[model samples]
Target chain A: MFPTPIQKRPVAAQALYQGLLPIALIMWLLPLIAVALFSIRPFSDFGAGNYWGWPSSFEMFHNYGQVFFNSDMPRYLWNSVLITVPTVVGAVALSCMTGFALGIYRFRGNLLIFFMFIAGNFVPFQILMVPVRDFTVSAGLYDTKLGLVLFHIAFQTGFCTLFMRNFIRALPYELIEAARVEGVSEWRIFWYVVLPLMRPATAALSVLIFTFIWNDYFWALVLTQGPNAQPVTAGITSFNSQFVAQYHLMSAGSIVAAIPPVAMFFLMQRHFIAGLTLGAVK
Target chain B: MSVTAPAVPHAPSERGWFQRNRMTLTPLLFLLPGVLFFAVYVVIPIFQSFQISLYEWDGLGEATYIGLGNYQELMTDRAFEVSIWNNVKWLVLYLLAIPAGLFIALFLNQTVVGIRLYKSLFFFPFVLSQVVVGLVFSWFYLPREGILNGVLAFFGLEPVNVLGDPTLATYGIIAAGLWPQTAYCMILYLTGLNAVDPEQIEAGRLDGAKGIRMLWYVVLPQLKPATFIAFVVTIIGALRSFDLISIMTNGGPFGSTRVLSFYMFEKALSEYGFRMGYGAAIAVVLFLIMLIFIGYFLWQMWQDEKEARR
Candidate 1:
């Protein structure tokens, strides 16, 4: 209702606004548009420098097939899945506890611990780079999906805890007090009372964590170097090196790597937005 | 899951530690797994990096201690200085997202048909990974054949080799980074706009305030939470910039696009003989810079907590 609506604006302004909207969007998405177009173009057409022109043929299926068959795309995808799934479960489960503790209870070192988690979450992963890698190697977990999973679980716990705590803190205290007065055990209160009320928060956190782990490039690169344990993000990098100017195949591979997160985002659109904008609007 | 003792209320002081702090202790049990992982993975490693900075080792060999030598090397390393300076530029230029986001939020805060689709399409770039974004931008910035170059040729200008040109390459990568970053900022601002009180806008309009003046004097003040969050995330994103730079340039054209994160990766890994110590030093410096801002944010949160308690 605000901004007087486009219909209520001057006719000239409305016309100008409509015209500019598409132009602005096109300009903004120019790069993505180019690559998406290129992905369907035949290699011959691409090699012939007909990038901006209409594609000579639709080779998207062929290009994508080649990425799947020739490269370690499946293995990489499996590795990503192996790492991300456990990380989501570990991070969410861990944060449920941490968030509950920090949110519901008052104790010594409460603020100190909360601040530490927050501060730790914001630090660059590079600081943890050497030590984490060494620890991974020493545990003989290097070049294994389990290695990446362990590190991710640990790292994500920081952000998850912060988010979870804020969410749990915002929950009404009266419900908790009422449960306590009824002689319901603390664990039962959490499981039956608080847990059900936390559905939205849980959904939001799950979607966000899923995307975060799926798209993680830094740790994937740091922890694993080969396709044996490499994730899609790092796999895309290696594929980039091998393909070298094979734009169609690279584009196809890029699209493949991007699909899971994009799908997750679309599927959980509400929760994704809710999670992302948690503190923003409030 | 234990039976409760019959209600026999006693003096609060006489309660055992377990009873006295039962609520807090119970939660800590839940916190143990998370706190332990956080400490091992995030907290301790930071100090570990600082310690690693003092040693010289190719991860496989014994680490030889060389106190402050890496810092000395960093002092004279032109590549280090240039990368650090580029990071400064990235931090500053990347901040344009905040205002740009607000502008877009205002533009889209209308009850128009197909506007929801428009917003989603605007948000498309953010849902994809940075690797995809990098590849897309690489194609766009390619000489002669790239869409950007095609547009340039239409205007009678020769093709510019953006990625190949050392001077322009960093800017090219930064631009790519900005695409998603700006979308993220816009989403934040949109949420902020949604929460803006209608009555306040009505009051402002009745007072004859309009356009930029209305925004600056009224709307923005109400959008403080969104702005604060946007600022925090954007600054952190800028500092932790690695993916786009790695994919697009690989610190290329003589490492012109090297930010600290990528540079640290190159130093510790890649074909650079794994100077983990030196890499850790670079990381430590970046962490120290981030720590300053993190400290300020925590202080503000603490103040808010104090006020809430009162």
Candidate 2:
């Protein structure tokens, strides 16, 4: 609206605007498009120096089949799903209680506790790297999916609490007060009253956290070792090493590693954007 | 007496301590699991890392206490200096994503046909893992097989090896990082723009403000929240720039692309042998730098809380 809508413009200008949209999008996504193009090409195309040319033959099914059946990709994918689902559930459930307490109750140390979560959330992961790893190893949970999941659930709680608390703060307070006056216990107020109203926030946070844990590379690298526990982000590196410069297979493998989160985003775009832009609108 | 006895049983004095103290106890009860987890995994480790930084340890055996030894060594380490300078460069250059995002947001703000689909497509990059983005860009910068070289040949210009050259490698990785970052900022601005006050824009238009002037005076003032968020995320993202660097360059072509985050990983982990103490020291430095921003952000939030309370 600020730019003066194209509908109000001259025919020539409108035509020019429409034509420019596709070009700009193409330029913006060129790198990804290139990878996508590479994914469908046969391995022979790279050897023949047909890098950007039309694929001599399309090997989409064969290349993807090889990635799924021949490699450790499926195991890594399963590992990612295993790690991500529990983290989402744990982080969300924990944050819901924390959010309810901070949003509904007036208590000493509330702001201090909330600020601690925020500051912890912002600290660099490197600061936590050595100590967290040492802690994990000492607890005898090292190099296991459970180790990664527990650490993720704990770390993600900081961000999730920030989000959930803010969201619960914006809810109508009278509903809570009414419940309290009716002799409903505090726990019941949270379960029956506050929890149902937090569905949108829960959905938004869940989608966001799922994508986050799924795409996590740093923790997956530090806490886990081999395909037995590593997520797809780290696994793709080994997948590439196994294939080396077979660009077609490597391209296909990378794309496959990236699909779950992308699909999550598309399916839950509204919630994803809502979660991300929670503080953007004041 | 019997009527008084039934009334007494229903009185506050007869309630259990748990019921009487439920108001205070409920919050503490709900907070227990989250607080415990956060303490173990996040809070306590922070203090532990600080303690570890003072000792010289190989992560496997006994640690020796050498007072500030790692920090003293860091003063003379050339790789550390390069990493610091590159971090400065990253902090400054990564900010370009904000304005670039605003520009793209403005370009796509119109309600053209299929605009929703277009918007989603434009935002697709941000959803991809940085690993994928790094891999995609690395191939895109390949000296021989890269389309960038192909494009240069099409224009009859010489092809340059972007990731292979030390001078250009850092910039190449930053550019890759900016791709997703810009998309993130664009979405934030788009959402902000959706909520802008139309009446004020009309008022500005009536006053003869047009285009850039209109944007500067009218639109941008309304987009402050989005801008602040963009600034926060971009700063944090710049500091946390490990994934792209690790995947794309691995601090290679002469270690030209290492930032503090990546360097810290290399020292403490990797096949470089585990110098846990030294790595913790590097992390401490990075933590101190981040603390400045963290302090400022918390202060702002505190001020906002006060205003809301008022």
Cα lDDT, model 1, residue B144: 65
Q: Could you give the TM-score of chain B for each candidate, in order?
A: 0.93, 0.96
> Residues B210-280, candidate 2, lDDT per residue (tens digit)?
99999999999999989988998999999999999999999998999999999999999989989999999
Off by over 4 Å in 1: B1-21
DockQ of each: 0.77, 0.83
Q: Chain A vs. true chain A, TM-score per candidate?
A: 0.96, 0.99
Clashing pairs in 2: none
Every model's TM-score: 0.95, 0.98
Residue-wise C-alpha lDDT for candidate 2, range A26-143, written one tens digit per residue: 9998888889999999988888999999999999999999999999999999999999999999999999999999988999999999999999999999999999999999999998
- The residue-level lDDT of candidate 1 at B183 comes to 89
Q: DockQ winner among the candidates?
A: 2
Give the alpha carbon lDDT tens digit for every residue of A64-154 in model 1.
8988899888888988888898989989888888888888888889989998988888898899999999999999998899999988888
Worst 10 residues of 1 chain A by lDDT: A1-10
